[model samples]
Target: MQPADGINLHSPPPKLKFEKLSAYKKRKLSHSTVNDTSPPTYQISSRAEESDNSSVVEPDKNLMAEYVDFVKVKPTKKEEVLRILNKKDVTSPKFFQLDSITREDMSHWGLNPGIIAQLRDNIKKFEKHLTPQ
Candidate 1:
């Protein structure tokens, strides 16, 4: 006789993953998008900065002259990235060659290009909305 209390004989269930609150919080730092869907966490370092300057730390004992070249201008706005992108229209060939990128790419890091395009098109329209009506 088949017993209802026993495990299923036909197939087994897929393994599941559960995230611990502390571990999940740490993971959140790696990808802030897990909560905030708007805006991004990082962007290009600009020409004034070394390609890998994102995490470079300056020590007090370090000579100013030696690290003079590393001084970088902080990005003030999203328009800056948009401005560079505007230079060529569409995505830049050189930009695609980058070794690393931010949370927000040409296609939301290409997670879903279709949705990214739709949102970008909306942004274009909204910017134009500010024009003379």
Candidate 2:
């Protein structure tokens, strides 16, 4: 094709893009077969647990202070006591102690507030169970 009358307006062709596939993908394409060997499961060693291996030294106070600071238990109080009671479904007359000492769900949670902590622990266990071995 002839160039423009007073300007060279020809543009180069666009570059082609080629993405590389991983080795796992290539193997999948060659064969669709899979081995039958199962994965491992985590198990606590009862023998070790029973042993009297208490040689490890106790942690120093400075180290303990650092750890405590790292895991500081700081909970900002925001929600009212009634809101918390409403969430845990603890509306029964038996739940309230002296009637005036109601606690907030925000500061803590359900009943002794420790139930919320247990709830968090149970959730962690559930997540561990869900993981692939």
Candidate number of the best lDDT: 1
- What TM-score number comes out for model 2? 0.19
Between which residue pairs do clashes occur in model 1? none
Per-residue lDDT tens digits for candidate 2, residues 30-131, read: 454344343322333443222233323343324322222222323332233334545655432222322233445324553345433332224233334435
Q: Model 1, stretches more than 4 Å misplaced?
A: 1-111
Q: Show pairs that collide, candidate 2.
A: none
Q: Which ten residues in a row are the worst by lDDT in model 2?
A: 64-73
TM-scores for the candidates:
0.18, 0.19
Q: 22-132, model 1: which lDDT tens digit per residue?
A: 877778765777677665535454631323323433333222211111222133523343444444343322232344432266544332444333333343233344359
How far residue 35's Cα lies from its native spot in candidate 1, in Å, is 48
Per-candidate count of clashing residue pairs (backbone under 3 Å): 0, 0
Q: By TM-score, how accurate is candidate 1?
A: 0.18
- Candidate 1, residue 29: CA error in Å? 50
Q: How many backbone clashes does candidate 1 have?
A: 0
